[model samples]
Target: MNETQRREQLKKIIEESEPISTGVALRYQGETKRVCVYRIPLDFLVYNKYNGRISSRVKAYERLNHELNSENDEDRELIEKLLWESKVERNRKTMEDLVENGQMRHGIVTADGVIIDGNRRASLLNRAYRERDKHKWSPVDVDKCRYFNAIILPQDAGPRDIQQLETTYQMGEDDKLDYNPIEKYLKVRDLTDVGFDIDEIAKMMNESTADIKKWQRTLVLMDEYLETLGYEDMYPMLDRVEDQFLSLSKGLKDWQDRSVLAKANWEYSDADIDDLKVIAFDYIRYEQEGKEFRRICKPGKEGSIFQDRLIWESFRDTHFETMDAIAEESVDEEIAHAHADIDVVDVLRARDSKWKSEISDSFKNNLKYSVRRLDDRMEDAKPKEILKKVRDLLKEIDTEQDSFLNDEGVATLVSEINRMTYRLKRELGQ
Candidate 1:
């Protein structure tokens, strides 16, 4: 049929049926006495949001009947079928398998009523009930079910009581399905109680035997400190503790007593202990080789001995100036060359020899003139004064010659000459 005609036909069929029930009463038949049901159209049921309409009990039955005939399943089954066809089909399929294998259960109840128990089942049932007509719904068996025997509280119970009961039921009935190591441990614990071997449980949970055991140990260890450390801090330590436990050739207690694990005790804070644990393992593996830790030198710090030596060499080379000069007229070529040598003793000896030779040359040239001048002046006037002057001049020249021949005296003279030459060159800008 076209869209308009189909909608019209649905409306006509609904209008011709009895209205949905507000309140239902059971009546017994003769003998076998199957229950006869009837409806009361209270204001609450007349505007019911569940089925989107108010009618007699017969209309509710008709809706259930139509769903059963069309989907070929009972009310609960039809709801489940529709759920499987919805967006959360995969989760519903898992739930269906759990239900089939007696790992999960199903139920139904009023929205205002306390859940008491079987809260997960009730929630799933309610969702299926609401989504029965959606495109995603698919049929499944709902006959196999499990429920807790619970005492229903009075309608006058306070909201607090209802809320408390709901929370308790959810906690008690809902499977705490978290994909964490703790959750896996809990699951393994549950499985173990039912006679599953540790290996079998590990296989089922997709974990190694050692991994499972480590998790168990961690759970025990962390239980005492969980309140202090909290999950945020403790989670990353789980894998580290596992690795440490597995890597131990000896018992876990031995590993714990080892210096490595002892050193790790301070990492109980939100520190990344895994990286530290790996480092500890590496240290143990290569302990004989010695650990090499980097020493960071801060900026502007003085350098090492080798670096200081290099710097000193560079400074000495670029700043210190040494100069030597010799006059060819003052000393023989060999003596002058020797005077310019870095060795002070050799230069001093050479300078003394050169000075003696120069003094000898000066004395020989002036001695004859000095004696003749004295003789010529002797006969004139003041002959004694002329001879005394001449003798004094000769004595002064002889004194100079004797001093030049002395090593210490020659050394002093050369030093004075060097000083004067240096000063003169500096002033002349040469």
Candidate 2:
């Protein structure tokens, strides 16, 4: 049927059927009755916006009250008031558009009157109704705002169905509000619990299977890892750890082919996994200490040394026991800044006081690595490119020579530059 016919059909059904009874008289307990459009009272509808879409219900009610109490409680002005006062400003434009055009589309609400979609619109309409009795409007249409049009789902639309539907409606569309990673993780988990596989859920939800699998695996790892750290209740913290956890997951997966890391069914063993979890937490702290410290950990790379299997293996082999001790103690301390070096084992092992000073010492290694990389790039460059780079390097060297106060270091760098200059001139025939 066409849009007008469909809306008229739903309205006819509502007109013919009795309004859903509340309390014990309501025959349907869950969302298991029948699909019917209802002209639900604005006051009866419950406001439950999630995933940072709207303000808290209490705040929303207050904002609604504030607008209603105003002298000019016009429909158009109130809509703007709610949109302007919304905690999530992203909803404002959509809400403004709806207000300008009026609600042409219907919202999906539960039999118990909880809005599943079009919350911003519903909330505004409710606000208009609440204000109708209290204030006078220049262009009044309070009767039109007294009730909201909704496709009330069956009472038997259980939690899983509601979650799936809500996610489908809100997050499945390209223009809809993007679910926070943690929120998406929880939704994917719910879908999985309801017997939907990765591919099935992806297709149903209009998401990629790869993303579904990634979220599932990362969520499992996060839950287990948090439980191991005795912080299972801190799941909210996982929101900030998305990048870290994903990188850690990728890092661990890199070990899938290795016999040692693959022992526990292609995953780390119980004990080893615990070790890795603790290490991951510690790595998070070190990462928070800022780039100055990160350079000390991985020298030139952006990620932690723990992410590198070759370097991590040596550190793990040399001080596995110390790592466990540090992990245990660090968790208790809630450490937010730890040593950044893979050789953190050595420092912890020796109880080295000089390690703090080694923060600046790491710059030498970073410089060496940077120079080696430059050498490799220059080797790959054309003669003209090489000549230009050589000239730039000579100027940069002269400018930076005074930066290092260590006479020995400066002299050594100068000697290397002299050699490079001689070799470059010979190669370029300059």
Candidate 3:
């Protein structure tokens, strides 16, 4: 519905329908006010594209595809699909509850009928009404599902307050849980983009100001990682790496602020940190995380390649060279040849598999060599422990292939290994 039509419709609904009473308390124009709830026809309301629950998904999808117009039926359907899928199992249970018990909690919408807090529930209501027969819903249940029970704000509601109220109410402790982690990060970014300060965002999200700043900083690094890999603004690539990014962002910040390691020799520059980001990005790209991912650059000498100048330079050069070589080939043909019914997610997954297959071993071997080199500098570290780690890495890789012999990096690394082995043998006086 257009703004004018919804305004007129809301006017009639407010005048004719008896309100269910003041059930919602909201912060409006810097004051707490209780708004009466009303039942409005579903047609008068539209899904909010920037709802925090799926904001990142919507953003990533729109960037990859096109902007969504909520007023358009096709676009509404697309938004509906995203909302439903954002938390599929939970949404399904909520839909079932709506069928059996009706809407227990009221939603908050603007006077012009844009839902501020109940996008998923609203989507589920619409879905339930559309598929009433499939669920064998009764006539009364179907009718009840047709109208949304919500607190409609005054017509003067501005976008700023609306967004703030939406953020506060939808994600409030008393409201729903199970939000996508990415949404919180992107929420801070979006609200910042629209001119909300960190304090304001923290208030709205019910998070501490420090945490809000941290999330924003982490989001910046995430964006840089995406842009570095030519996947700018595509957040689905970060599906399961939230924890890793948080650690990496903190690590990078620590190094930048310190310039030198806590107890190590090498001092780092901004350029060096950027190289570390790319190296971590590659490891993250190929399914490395936790201790393995942290060992790459966790801000200390104990297994960090950047702790020593030589290790840092060798690792960064080897990593970037391998990465550039991998990026030399185009995957557009393979993506284009995917099955017609294949989805973008699957296509991206296939591309990811292709990348991991081609680059993971090189990334791993280089990291292992660099890590061992760092350990070698630790005179207190046991040789047997380091050698055991090397043996494990060797067992995981096959060196007998003809392709291995042909690889210049592999040959050079093996030569270095032989030289080190000769030194150890001569020192033993065999």
TM-score of each: 0.22, 0.51, 0.88
Task: Give per-model CA RMSD.
Answer: 40.9, 13.2, 3.4
**Candidate 3 at residue 365, lDDT?**
85
lDDT of all predictions, in order shown?
A: 0.34, 0.52, 0.81
Worst 10 residues of 3 by lDDT: 326-335
Query: What lDDT is obtained when candidate 3 is compared to the true structure?
Result: 0.81
State residue 36's C-alpha deviation in candidate 3, in Å.
0.5
**Per-candidate total of colliding backbone pairs:** 12, 9, 0
How well is each residue in 1-430 modelled by candidate 1, as lDDT tens digits? Answer: 3334433433443346443332222111112212111111111110111110111121223432342331122543433333333225555655555445533332112223223333333334444434545634444533222222222233354433333333223322324231223334444444555565667556544557886677566455444332222222222223223333233222223334443333221222212222223322322222212111000000012111111223223322221211012233332344345534243324433454454454443333332343244234333547467657656764675445666667697678669967976886798799
Q: Model 2 segments beyond 4 Å from truth?
A: 1-38, 48-87, 94-99, 127-146, 225-235, 256-274, 285-310, 313-430
Per-residue error (Å), model 1, residue 296: 21
lDDT of 2 by residue, 88-206 (tens): 56544544444345566666776566677666677666555555445553234555565677777664778766766676666676744444456666667767887767876786568
Ranked candidates, highest TM-score first: 3, 2, 1
